[model samples]
Target: MECLTSFCETHLQPHQIAPALKRHKLINPVKNLEDRMCKKHKKPLELFCRTEQMCVCQVCTVTDHKGHHTVPLKKEFGEKKAELGRTKNQMQQMIQKCLQKVKEIKHSAELSNRDAEREREESEQVFTTLVRSMQRSQAEVSKMIGEKQKATMRQAESLIKELEQEITELQRRCSELDQLSHTKDHLHLLQSSPSLCPPTSTKDWPDVSITQNESKWNVQKDISQLDKKVRRALSELEEKLNNVLEKSKGDDLKRMQQYAVDVTMDPDTAHPLIIVSGNGKLVRTGHLEQNHFYNLKRFRSRVAVLAKEGFSSGRFYYEVQVKGKTGWNVGVAKESINRKIGGLYPEQGFWTVWLSFQVDYEACTDPHTPLSLKSKPEKLGVFVDYEEGQVSFYDVDTRSHIFSFTGCTFTEKLYPYLNPFDDYDGSNSAPMIITPVNQTP
Candidate 1:
C-alpha cells in the first residue's frame, strides 16, 4: 500500500495482517498463495466445473470452461463424501458375501473328507474278505494232501510189523530143527521128526512180501476241485458285491438328483429330420426334412439333438423318457463332437447308452459292449460330474445304475446328448422327451 502511495504504510493496520505472513510462509498467506491459485488466471479456485469434474476459478468458467455448469467447492465436496459413504456400504456387503462363501466352502470340505474316509474303510474290508477266502481255501487243500501222506505212512508201518513177526517165527523154527537133529537117540529123533512136520503153519514165507504198489495222490483232481470251489466263491462274492453296490447306487442317485438341471432341446443343433417340440422338451425324427433352414451347428446326418445348456464345471443331472422308443441313445457328449460324420460312440466324444430295434441294450463304447440291464429304463437319468470326469446312466424307475463312463479327460464343455435313431420301418419313431427329475427318497 505504501508503494502504491494511494494508502500510506503508516496508516496500515497490523491487526488485519495474517500470522503466517509474520511467520515466513509457515503456510501460504499473502504474497504467494498455494495450489488453490488458478494457473491460467491469478485468482483463487473457488468453484467446481461440473462438466469437466475439476476445480475452476470464475475466470476459467468464461475462458477454457465456457458456458459450463459450475457449483461451489463446498457443495461438490459434500456430494462426493456422500457417494463415498454409499460405496463403503456396498463394499461391506460384498465382504459379507465373501465370508458367507468361505463358510460354504468349509462345509463342503468337511463332507468330502467324511466321504473319503468311508470309501477307504469299505475298500479295506473288501480286500480283507478276499484275502481271508484265499487263505481258507489254501489251508483246506494243504490239510487234504497231508492226510493222504499220513495214510500212506500208516500202511507202510503195518507192513513192516508183519514182516518183523514173520522173521521171528522163521528163526524159532530153525532153532527147533537144529535141536532135534542133534539128538543122539534114534527113537528121540524119529518122535521129534513126526511132531515137527517141517514146522508148517500152513503159510508160505516166500509169498509173504510187502505190498510194492505205492499210494498215488490224485493231486491234480484236488487242485481242479479247489479251483472250481474258489471260482464259485468268487462268483458268489461278486453277486453279493453287486447287490451291495446297487443299493449304494440307489442312495447315490438321490444325492445326484440334488444337482438336477432343467434341460431344454437346442433346436439349432438338431438334425434336419429331427422334429423338436415347441417347448424344447421333446424331439423325434420325421419322415422327411422339415424344410428348416440349414444351420451349421446342426447334426447333418445323425438324428440327434443337444440340450440348450452346456456345463464346463461341477456336477449336473437330467432325466429323459424313452418309454416307447425302441432305438435311442441318451447321455452326454463333448461340444467338439463331429457335427458332420462319425459313429456316436465314446471315440467320437459320446458317452451314451443305446437300445436297438431288437430291444438289445448296449453302451456305445469303443468296442460297443452289450449291457445286461434287468429291465429297460422307461425313464433314464444322466449324471455328469465334470470335475470328476464321470458320466453315468441310471434307470430312473428302478433307481439302479445302468452304466458309467469313468476316467475320462474332458477339456471342453459337455452337453446333454439325445439321439433318436433313424426311423427305419417306423418301428422306432417314438419321441424322446426330456423329463423332470424325481429324486429317490
Candidate 2:
C-alpha cells in the first residue's frame, strides 16, 4: 500500500499539480511572480509607510547592500508612486500647453495668410490700373503722332500739285512761243518774195493784211505782259518757298520773330548821370543841382513798361546809367508807371539805383530844389542788398560787384530815377551805365 500510495502520489501529482506548476512557471508567468515577490519583499513597515521614512527589504539588504543605509519599502514605494503621479500630471499639462501653442500658431498663420492674400489682391488691382492708364496715354500719343503725320502728308501733296501746275503752265507757254516763231518765219518768206503775188483776192487783201498785223501786235504785247507777270509771281513764290524751307530746317525759325532796338548813345552823353534812355538819348538825368525828373519824349514807343505793353513778349536787352550823388536818393524804379509823367515806376515794376561814396558829400534835391555848389563832395559808389530789396548794383559790364544797399524803396509807377548828388558831377557826369542782360548780337 505504501508503494501504491507513493506511486499514486508521484504520478497523479505530477500529472495534475505538476502541470499546473509548469504552466505557472512559463517565462511571463514567472516574471510576474518574481515581480510580486520583489514587491512583497520590498514592502515597508506600517509606521515607515505612514511616516514616509526610510525602510528597505531583505532583497535590498542582502549581498553588497547588507548593513547599508536604506529607506523603508513602503516609504520608497509611496515616494516613487507620488513622483510617478506628479510626472503623469506634468505630462498631461505639457500636452495641454502644446495643444494651446499649436492652436495659437495655426490662428496666426491663418491671419497672416489672409493679410497676404489681401495685399496681393490690392497690388494686382494697382498694377491693372497702371497698365490701363499707360495704355490710354500710349493711345493718345499714337493718335497725336498719326495726326501730325497726316498733316505733313497733306502739305507735301499740296506742294507737289502746285509744282505740277507750274510745270504745265511753263510747257504751255513754250508751245505758244514755238507756234509764233514758225508763223513769223512763213511771213518773212512771203514778204521777201513779193513778186509772187500768190492767190491775191482783190476783194480785201489790204484789209486782211492790216487786220492780221494788228492782231499779231496785240498778241505780242499780251505775251510780253503775261511773261512779266509770270516772272514776278515766280520770284515772289520762290522767295516764300525758300523761307519756308529754311524755317523747317531748325530752331532758327525763332530768330525771325525777334525785334531789335538799335540804341546809339551820343559819345558825350554816354555818362553815368543818365539813368534811362530811349533811342540812345537820355530820358532820365541825374544832375548835381537838379531834383529827379524824367523826359517823357525820350520814352520809345517800343519801350517795355508795365502800364504799356509789358516787357516785350520776346527776349530783349537795354542799358541805362545811374549817377551817384551825396544825400540824393536815386535808383531804378520797376513795375509801376508815372501816369502824370508818362512813364512806369516801381508800382509798375521800376527799381531804384543807389550808390555809395567813400567821402562825405552834399545831397541834391529835385530839379525844383537844386543843391548848392558850396557843399563839398567825395568819391561815390553803388550798393545793392537783396534782403532789403530785389535791386542789385553791378558794374557797367555787370561782371564785377559794385555795392549793395538795404532798406531802400523805389517808386513803382514812375520810370527809374537817378540823383546826380549820388555821384554825377560835371567832371564825372557819367557814373553808371546799364545794358540789357543777354542781348542778341
Candidate 3:
C-alpha cells in the first residue's frame, strides 16, 4: 500500500488518481450482466464449484457441489498458471534431447555411407587386377609355346633344304652319265668317273623327326599348372583379405602362436644313415653309419627323423628351413608309422610334401598329388589342430598358406617328420634345418 501511494504521488496528483481509479474499477455493462448473474439460480455467481467444474452461487455450491472437493477461483487460477509454466519448461527440454539424438543418427548414417562406398571400390579393383593377371599369364604361356615351335620348325626347314640340294646334284650326275653312254667317248666317260665318286658330299638322313607332339604335351602340362597356380593365388588373396577384415575383431594366427613349442630332432627315431647336427635341429644324409643299435621305432631305409615332442591334442605350430635344399620331405606323421615299409603315403601314416628332381613340391598321397606353387618355399610353417583334426602348411617367407589336410582323425600322437633324401647334386647337400618361427605382426 505504501509503494502504491508513493507511485501515485510521483506519477499523478491525489485528486486526479481517484477519478482514474474509479474508471479502472468500472466493469463493462454487457460483460457484467452474464458473469454477475447465475443462469439457473438468477443470483450473482459468487463461488467456483471444483467438482462440478462450473461457476455457482453460494446456495448451489451447498446443494449440488456438497460433499465434493472445491476450491476458490483465485486459488485454482494460481495453481494452473504455475503448472503451465512447468509444462513449457519440460517440453523445451524434450525438444533439445530430440535434436541431439537426430545429430547422432545423421553422423552414423554418413559414416556408414562412406564405408560402403570404399569397400565397393576395393572389390572392383581386386577383380580387375585378377583379370589382368590372368591375361598376362596367358600371353606369357602363348609366347613360350610359340618360341619352342618356331625353333623346332626352323631346324626342320634347314635340314629339308640341304636334302633338296643333294638330290639336285645327283640328278645332274645321272644326266651326264646318260650322255656319255650315248657317245663313243669311253676315255671322256672314264675321265669323268673321277669326278662322279658316288656323290660323297651327300648327308645321311638318320630318321630326323620333329617331336612337335611332345612339345605340345609339355605346353599343355605347363598351362594346366599355371591355371592351378592362378586359382590358388586368387584363393590366397581372398583368404588374406578376409583375414585382414577379421583382424579388426581377432586373429587366429596369434591364438595358434600361443601354442608354439620348441621342437628338436629325436635321434632315437632317426635312420641309422641319417646324421643329426649337435643342436638336434639339422639333419642330412651321412656316409658314416650311426653305430647306434636299431630299435622298433627307428626308420631303416628312409633317411627320416622325428621331432622330440609329439602332439596328442590341442593346436601346435613349428617352422622348418628348406632353403637351398632339394629332394627333401617334411611334414607330420603318426607315431605308429611303419619303420621298415619305407613308403611315404597318407595311408601309411605319412603326410608330407616331397621336393625332388624336376618337381617343385608334391604332397605324398596314394598317387602323390603335385602342388602348384608360385615359388619354392624357403621357410615352411606347419600348423596342427590335433583336436580339430586339421593340419595346415604355410610359406613363412611370403606369409601365405600352401596346403592343408583336413578331417584327419588322429587316434595316436603325431610327430613332425623330416626326410633329407639323398641329395640331388652338390646344390642339394644343404641340411634340412628346423628354424624358430618368428611371430607374425
Model 3 per-residue lDDT at 388: 84
lDDT of 3 by residue, 283-384 (tens): 888766679887898888788899989989977888889888767888999998888875787777887877875466877777877788877788887889
Judging by lDDT against the true structure, name the best candidate: 1
For all predictions, the C-alpha RMSD in Å is 8.0, 35.9, 24.0
Residue 298 lDDT in candidate 1: 89
Candidate 2: tens digits of C-alpha lDDT, residues 1-441: 111122344554553465554442212112223333334453322222223233434554663356555665556678889999999999999999999978966875675576556656655654565556556655655565565556666766766676677668667766655555567577665664533333323245233222334445655565566556555655665565544443332212122112223333432222233454444434334453223344542332312221121232222223344443223334443333332344223344434333334243222212122223222322212232233453433333323322333454532222233333332444434433333433222
For model 2, how many clashes? Answer: 69
Q: Judge candidate 3 at residue 170 and give its lDDT.
A: 86
Query: How many collisions per candidate?
Result: 0, 69, 0
Model 2: lDDT to the true structure = 0.41
The segments of candidate 2 whose C-alpha lies over 4 angstroms from its true place after superposition are: 1-31, 38-72, 185-441
Judging by TM-score, tell me the better candidate of 1 and 3. Answer: 1
66-149 per-residue lDDT for model 1 (tens digits): 999999988999999999999999999999999987886686667557655765666567667878999999998888777777
lDDT of 1 at 205: 56
TM-score of each: 0.64, 0.31, 0.45
Give candidate 1's whole-model lDDT: 0.81
